[model samples]
Target chain A: MAVYHADALVIRSREYGESDRVLTLFSREMGKIQAVAKGVRKPKSRQRAGAQLFTYGDFLIHKGKSLDTVSQCSPKESFSYLWSDLDRSLAASAMAELLDISTISGQPNAELFTLTLTCLFLLEQYETSLLLSAYALRLMVILGYRPHLGDCVECGERLQGERLFFSSEAGGTLCGRCRESYSGRMVRAGSIAFMRQLIQADLSKLDRLRWAAWMREEVLETLRHYLEHKFERPLKSWRLGNTISDGLERHIRSLNGKEGKEFE
Target chain B: MDFLNYPQPLADLISSLARLPGIGPKTAGRLAFYLLQQPQISQDLAQAILTANHSLKKCSICSNFTDQDPCALCQNPQRDSTELCVVEHPRDVVSLEKTKEFKGRYHVLHGVLSPMEGIGPEQLTINLLLKRLKGVQEVVMALNPTVEGEATALYLARLLKPLGIKVTRIAHGLPVGGDLEYADEVTIARALEGRRQL
Candidate 1:
């Protein structure tokens, strides 16, 4: 059996046969690889921590006939905060979902690797929606789908307006003349600028930027359409995140007994 | 040529059994041969599978698989109407009931929120649980200790807490007879988080 070790991130994990887990691990050295972590679901299994979702670890793998086997592993970071909260965990889940759908096995992008690690760590301290939107925007940039933001994707003219037209199909902001060429949404200038800043910002210093509720939501929706256009399929986690947030909002209002005064 | 070269009917049986969760082709062949050797065993197993599949329906109140609408547990007057225990599956309800400690009725979500698996709140019975929460003071979440399970529990807590209902989760910790030295940090942290003054 060929044995090798890599510092890996558990981007996705699913239950396999009894007490076993199949892991989609992302390592700077190996890119993405699928391996079976035998018996990780068992209480005594030492690999349990490293096999968890969003965990960063050093893994020793034994290459087998079909699926690689995880021989040994020790967690470097569990991103444990992601597990304790609902929204943050779902945000991390979205990151994993994007990576899983966007990347292929055996081709490693080191910059994307660093971005994923930095973003997941920052997610522990920051607001989930803004951080996740920024991560998604930056992720697309790193993946070479850098949206043309300075000017119209079609006409190549710098757009200056209170509200700008953005098209996922056109791959960026479109001028008033080019807007009619593509069907897209009318978005605030601040939202487009926020996305541009997110794409250009350093990953390590991402939290330095404040979370603007209006800007992030708009950017996220636009990016959602952009990603679906690029990937040709909507991500499950992205949709689930919206559903959860909407449910929570309704729940919060009910708890506060926020109702009209007709009853009073 | 295929090994064993079984007859068409035998091959079909072997292929069907191999499609089960854990059984492999070799195990399926072994089982098929064993079944053929014992006629009564094959008949009894087929009858059980058909009966279970044909008769079982989700209970109206809890969503647990039962032959009757309200299920025996829902019909029982001993169960606390003021409290409800929510779980991911009917098997989980059975496991909790075996303890005989929880006096409340159960609402099975049928699944936890697992986005990667394409499972969400819509795929679960969360709406049913929400509608049934009237007159219930507390909803105790007895979900599994997995990531999806914890997330589902947290989501439900947030959803139910707004209705003036006290929502709580079953304590997640080291298993019985599990050594402290072998326990993972997540387990240890949760155990400490849920620690009580004794």
Candidate 2:
């Protein structure tokens, strides 16, 4: 069995047998790989910490006939905050799910590797809706499925005005005229403008952008439909994240009950 | 006339057993030989499997595997109706029931939100949960501490809370009676952060 080392991001992990884990990793050197971490479920196991999902690490793996075995691993970037916060964890899970669905085995793409790491880093730092929207858009861009933001996807005409439609089947924006032929969800001008900014802007500089709650809801709904159409499967992480936020909002409201609000 | 050199029925038995989780071909082969020595045991096992497969039905309210429509727990009037405990699997219902702590009804998700494996909200028993939340006041999310579990809990919470019902998760942290030295840093940190007034 050939042994090799790679900088890997664990996209998915599930328990196997009594004390083992089956891990799906997206590596910089090797695109996506499924490896087994033996005894990782045991408390004293060295590979336990490193085998966790979203833990970017330096992994030394043994290439077995069927699946690679994780021989040794040391964490480079655990992205621990994602696990600490419910919202961040959901966002990270969504991004990881996208990566798992989009990529195939053994095809290395540095763009995707960097994008995954960057998105996780950004998600940990910020809880803004722009962070997730940008990550999803940028990921699609890296995968060469970049949604056409500026012009009408059906016609070559430059899009104008407030009313816009996004077509996942058509792969981008559609004008009022083109919207008739293509089926898509209607999105407001602010969503389109924000999407345009997201496409043009760096994720690091996203903090500077003034984010509105309505814009966040619009963009998220738009992207959710877009992703579902393209992927042919609903993104679990998106639903999970939305649910976490909704639950949080409700929790805050209950804490500040009607009686408490009257006092304030 | 043996194909690939195994006894006729033994090969079939090994192949069947091999398909089960955690069973390798070698273990399956061994199990087949072991079963052959105990013919009565094999007959009983086959009968049990067939009977369970034919008889088991999903409980209408809880979605747990039951011989009855609403299951015993859901049918029981004594179960606390106001506070519902949401769990990922029916086995989780079993585990939680052992604690005898929660007196509420249960909604088994059947599985968590796992998109990688093509599992989503629609795939789970979530809509049933939503429909059942009409009269419920609080939902206790008793999902496992895994990423998928946490995601599922949050997703259900999001859905349940909007109905003006309170949603709470089972506190995640160190295990009861677990040593702090053995506990992972993340678990320890969460424990400290969620520490309540003693």
Candidate 3:
């Protein structure tokens, strides 16, 4: 067996037997590789921290007949801050979930690996949940599951202004007359523009974008629809995000009431 | 033919390693050979694994991985103790903290209340959370805006309303950085209805 080294992101892991674990990793050079860490559950395993979920690390693996073994691991980025808060953690999970579903095992897609790692890092930095939605949407586009956001798919006419419809079946923007031909939901002009921008914009500029309340919901719903259509399963992490949002609002209102008492 | 020269233990190790999360068969073979080549590396790997296994524990308060029973957030006096945000997992707390919008304690449910999966209130940390609500003025249900999330939020709302706590949900509408042209009408209307004075 040949020994090889690569930088990998731990997407997920499953227990194997009593003292071993199977890690699903996305590597920079090799794309996605599933490897085993032998006796990782034992006391004093060297690769424990490096093999943790959501950890980015430099890994040394040994080639086996069927799988690779993780021999050595060194942490590069842990994104430790994400564990402190619930919302950030859920967003990160959503990002990881996307990476897990979009990429296939043993298929080396360097672009997707880099994209997933970068998104995970950015997710740690971004405060709003919108960033998570944007990252997921952008990932789908990168993976060739992108929806149509341009001119009407049926008539081939340019979409005028903000009034446009999105046909999930048609896979792009639809003009008024073209929209009548389909049964998908209508998309606001602003949302269409935003979807276009998300597809075109650089990751660095994501922070500068100003998302309105209505636009955020639209983007989320549209993306959710696209994902459901593509993956055929609703993202579990999205549901988790909504729960956290609900908890946050209630907490804030109670605080407000306390402040109100002080004012009185 | 090579079985006579190769030790059964080494081959067994390779097979075991190959079965792990991301280890392919080739990589697993490499690892087993490496172990034979460098015995010291194996020792180091063994030790690191033992440390994490023995030392790490989840915080009793938030269900986050911590050495202490109650995490720093739960014990911190500077945080807004009166407000508690209940989330599905420890990661949700991290996302909200990045926003710098919230300043309160948290309760990590470890998992969501999924009826289809047989994950109900008993499966979560709901009781531990309710016990912490003594002085908390409000409890925010910051779950994902999905079906299960909505169901969990609604369930909590009904449970908490009688407690006289002002239960509110985060505004669901357009995102702060999203474009308006692509939004759907239902989302737009919901956002408009949930709009605040500010």
Q: Pick the candidate with the highest lDDT.
A: 1
The lowest-lDDT stretch of 10 consecutive residues in candidate 1 chain A is: A255-264
TM-score of chain B of 2: 0.95
Best by DockQ: 1
Model 1 scores what on Cα lDDT?
0.84
User: What stretches of model 2 exceed 4 Å from their correct place?
Assistant: A1-6, A39-50, A58-62, A71-91, A124-129, A140-197, A208-264, B1-11, B75-83, B131-138, B162-166
Local accuracy of candidate 3 as per-residue lDDT tens digits, B26-94? 788878888879989999997987987888787887777666767778788899988888888777788
* Local accuracy by lDDT, each model: 0.84, 0.79, 0.72
The candidate 2 chain A region of ten consecutive residues with least summed lDDT is: A255-264
Better of 1 and 2 by lDDT: 1
Q: Candidate 3: which docking quality band?
A: incorrect
Candidate 2 residue pairs in backbone clash = none
**Cα-based lDDT at residue A242, candidate 3:** 69
- Cα error, residue B42 of model 2, in Å, equals 1.1
TM-score of 3: 0.57
lDDT by residue for model 3 over A1-264, one digit each (tens)?
399997998876666766687888888888788899887654345565566567788899999998799988877877655534445666666677767777777778877777777777787667556677778777877788777776777778877775677877677778777677666777788988887787688887788778898888888887777786678776766665665466546554553465324423
